[model samples]
Target: MSEKVISDYNGYDYKKEFWENVDREYEDQADRMAIRRLLPKRMEKFADIGGGYGRLANEYLKRARKVYIFDYSKTELAQAKEIYGDKIETKAGDIYKLPFKDNELDGLMMIRVTHHLKDMPKAIAELYRVLKPGGVAVIEVANKRTLPKMVRYVTFRSKVNPFSKEVANYKEISADGFYNYHPKYVEEIFNKTGFKRERVLSVSNFRSKTLKKVFKTNNLVKMEEAAQTALAPIRFAPSIYYKLRKPEK
Candidate 1:
């Protein structure tokens, strides 16, 4: 049976009707970049840990022969089933104790999942376990080193006065709010876990919510391209992304 852990999103439904109906193209550019780093090889068997609502799985299904999703959120799994049909097979499971056999998957995609983990080592070990010899995996983090993120965290933890500091910009405790991560820490963990590091990709470059708002127009492709370049230099910096492969046994 799947473990009953606390909802990482603090009850926010990532698959709720409003979230699915809202114009996500404006905000999903970062997501697309994260997914692309995984680069699902055609006709391979893939597993998506923390595959919330199958958003990233939707992209994987287009390339892979078989795709399995493991998610703790039943609400997201329900939405995934409704939207993806049989293209995705979902298991209501936690990342800590994956249900699959060892060395079975060809690739793994952990999109937007790492920051929410209660235990990062256990989760990465499970990921390494299911992936077969020579299998690749993509991991994404919130990049705590980013200037924008630093300011936000500092302000949130400020003690002197609430009026003087900026108000907490992020209102909801989505999946990442519970357990936070930095890229260097992730790299060290992965290395200690025996997964060989490959490449890194950065998503949002600037910390300006104002700039994001200004660019959140109908022209999503243009906006993403601009953001991609802006964020390219720090793609390997903290709050970045990376590809890893399980060493061949």
Candidate 2:
């Protein structure tokens, strides 16, 4: 069998190059908002899977008694340690083979990490194995069937079919290992894994350069917050966030 294709960020300063330099405050805020809504208020143990440099640590730290930032990159974990200083524990490991034992975590989250995973089924099974019965997991996926992409496909501007369930690789246009998934395809995987879907949020609804140029960030965030739940059923956004729970029993 071939080895799994994982996105490595060892030497990369994702916090600086990806978040700070890119001016993606709107996307960042939107992500935080979605996480806050989904994450449980109180938990004994919670983890942020693939949480590089603990970017979303503040959101879960106050809620969970013990919070961990798990990633594959030691450099990113080191940076997280520097910023958090033991407030959050940092662990280095692969997603398919989590370090924790079965039913260990009370809650967990994976944001912007699923896109980098080539094997969704295997990765999600690991999430299921780690979470305790009735545990909550907030997962985010890069959506392929977004409104803009669908429009492009319908107008014959793009060859890729937005309605297909296959994973859409963006290596040609963007970074290697970057991928997008049809919402239904991901949902099917979650269902097969026995995770009960509780809530879905269509985040980053207005992620457009033109929209950012026209409106203030705060204004755009307000609109985004309103549209998240409203447009979730359609999964009309580029990023889809799901709140899932393992069955109690």
Candidate 3:
């Protein structure tokens, strides 16, 4: 049986929303670059877990012989199929109980999706289950320890504990959302799941209303690249990218 978990995505019609907005383009690009950089060099096949609308999976075509869009969202999965045609394959299942056979994937990525998961360990174990011994996986974390949040806490204007190992609850303009994790917590889970951490990058560093208004998207992307290259050791961005590998048997 699939493990029971809490999530904010059960009935969300993502195709009718989110990506449709012109304003959210830069945010999309921010995550796109993170996944692109950490993608495996040689991939025979890979599954883009929780890949809605196939936005991130589309980018994997350059590396993978086949890219699979695996998600439980009917609307978004249909949209992905219509948009990409036969270029990508679609699979329907819960991430807790992946549909693929054991050792089926050479690479995998779960981007912009982990925040909604309430059971991170079980999900990570499932990811490890289907991946070949030598396969690579890239996952994203919605870092609660962002620089802005910490600065706000120091200035006495915020209630969020950026350093808390516990999941942080948040509210949004549309709905009350799920929780975000500290990067260290996610790192510990990956380590416990038998994955070797390959790399970590602090991306979406320029994710602020003021900064976005003052700069163009192209310029923001350039600066994001520079931050990722120079500040490789620190993870103070709102989004943290992790590259992991299953140990070679």
Prediction 3 TM-score vs. true: 0.91
lDDT of 3 by residue, 1-249 (tens): 244553544467675577775466677887888877899767998899999888776579778888899988876788889999998999988888999998999999998887777688889999999999999999988888888889988898888888889877676622445667898898999999999999888888888888889999889988888787566577788888889999999
Best-to-worst TM-score order: 2, 3, 1
Decoy 1 TM-score against native: 0.78
**Model 3 segments beyond 4 Å from truth?**
1-3, 6-16, 171-177
Error of 3 at 31 (Å): 1.9
Clashes of each: 4, 0, 0
Candidate 2 runs further than 4 Å off: 1-3
CA deviation > 4 Å runs, candidate 1: 1-12, 21-24, 152-177, 206-208, 217-239
Higher-scoring candidate on TM-score, 1 or 2: 2
Model 3 RMSD, rounded to 1 decimal: 2.4
The per-model lDDT (C-alpha) reads 0.67, 0.93, 0.83
lDDT of 2 at 101: 94
RMSD of every prediction: 5.6, 1.2, 2.4
Cα lDDT tens digits, model 2, 115-208, are 8888899999999999999999999999999989999999999887889999888776555657899999999999999999999999999999
Cα lDDT of model 1 by residue, 1-249, tens digit? 233234453245776544466655544666675566457557478887888787766567877888888788877777788888888888887778898899989887887665565567777889899889898888776554556455554778633221222212121555333444555566788999999987766664533456657665445456555655466555423346678988887
